[model samples]
Target: MDLTPRTAPEAAAPSTRRRWVPLLVLGLVVAAGGVLVARFLTSAVDYYCNVDEIGERAGCEKGRSLRVQGTVEDGTIERTDGTTSFVISFN
Candidate 1:
């Protein structure tokens, strides 16, 4: 029986294909994960500030979840029924 091994081209073909398969699969997985994370983070919550730019562009209204930046009004801190409230004045 002839015991000579296969030629170099035959041996190299399978090795090259095996090496690239895992790399391609890993790249696809990472891309999918990135898209999922981006969608989740953006949809989780929306933040809006009631400061100068936002307040001027839009208007300030009550019962809106907002971030307000202003100077605390003097003598406006009051405690009523164990609940504290303060008034702020913005320029």
Candidate 2:
């Protein structure tokens, strides 16, 4: 006579994937968050520079927008429509 206990069939057991679905989704969310933070850090640098460093500083290159620390020349700050033009002196 067989003494081994009978076992349930494979179809009766729960799928292994049921336990990993939530973990997989959590991992994806974490990865996406990391990417967003990295992008923000790289693009959010507002370089503070002097007017004399326009061409001498890497962050103050031509056509690049950054914070310039200097005196705005007399009558050089002009505001027309949506644009503002200005010139600064380091002296």
Candidate 3:
């Protein structure tokens, strides 16, 4: 008489992670594209200055592009040689 045990071969489990890697990579690519577009759009906007901020003269200089906001005084408009100039008060 003999005492012995028999064993059967088992197959490996299938992997489900392969499907998620491509999706994750696609999401990352879309997010990076959005950030780059936003940065470029913001850079195109021009800078502006207030009436009281003219004396600072840090970023303000001649021939530089900028916007200024002020209220024109009554009857201060002058037109000469197809040009116009006006005086503004901060009051």
- TM-score, one value per model: 0.42, 0.69, 0.44
Model 2 misplaced stretches (Cα beyond 4 Å) = 1-14, 79-82
lDDT of 2 at 25: 99
Best-fitting candidate, scored by lDDT:
2
Give the lDDT of residue 69 in candidate 2: 87
Q: Lowest-scoring 10 consecutive residues by lDDT in candidate 3?
A: 55-64
Output the number of the TM-score-best candidate.
2
Model 3 local distance difference test score:
0.77
Considering TM-score, which of the candidate structures 1 and 2 is the better prediction for this target? Answer: 2
* lDDT (10s digit) by residue, model 3, range 1-91: 6678767678766567877889899999999999999998887766576666675766555565677777888899999999999987766
How much does candidate 1 score in TM-score? 0.42
